[model samples]
Target: MDESTGLTIHKSEAVALTQNGGLAKAIKPLTKEIHLFDTYVAGVSYLKDKTVLQEIKIKDRLTLQREDNKFDDKAIVVLSSDGKKLGYVPEKDNIIFSRLMDAGKLLVAYIIEIKKRSIDYQQISIGIYLVDF
Candidate 1:
């Protein structure tokens, strides 16, 4: 049963689950963990180099931390590969992602694509992957 989409998919019917349209569609079996949905980034000003964001590796691992200082109750800090401050998880999409991260779920983020936009939040986009044990 997937919590996000509320779809119950048995392990034996994983293939049919994907065909039936659910979170299973986003899932891919990779070893013991399932590769789940992707997450995005916001607050571009905190990024080290907005101009060079596109240069980041596509599948490079990132870090997520709970931030309660000046943001929402679900604020999640998105960090770079080398432990630098990249930005944050977008507010609208941070709820589930933050909760999952805080619950000690193995969630991973990668640099998917970076769009050069005038608005800050519209700048860099990060891809989120989940691994459950």
Candidate 2:
């Protein structure tokens, strides 16, 4: 796969979806059968190309507050696959973000939104690539 193109694609196995509580186990005693439910595809794209599309409303809302002073002293944390903190990317910096999507590994993204006097993001999009053979 080409990293320069900024594309990510991977395959995953579907497992049983269980309820947060003991709802499934409680119902198991009432019935002896378990049926498969509906399924849907979840596609998450993190590219900055024309082919990569994002909702206009979300994009607009993300950059609604465009000001310098608002993000002067804010903290932005970046993470790696092993739950290690990489560093912080400035609010208005153009960053090329990449991540690995292993078969059973989890990807985490944390964003702390703070309502302040101003906001600004020089780079609105992130580049993503999947390099699994």
- Which candidate should be chosen as best, given lDDT against the real structure? 1
Point out the worst 10-residue segment of candidate 2 by lDDT: 35-44
The 10-residue segment of model 1 with minimum total lDDT is: 24-33
Model 2: per-residue Cα lDDT over 26-119, one tens digit each: 5556543222111111111222231222222111211111113354433333333333332334444312221112233222232222222222
Clashing pairs in 2: 67-119
Error of 2 at 126 (Å): 5.0
Tell me the deviation in Å of residue 16 in model 1. 40
> Against the unseen true structure, what C-alpha lDDT does each candidate score?
0.70, 0.28
How many clashes does the backbone of model 2 have?
1
TM-score of each: 0.61, 0.20
lDDT against true structure, model 1: 0.70
lDDT by residue (78-128, candidate 1, tens digit) is: 877776777888888888877887878767677776665666444556767
lDDT at 127 for candidate 1? 68
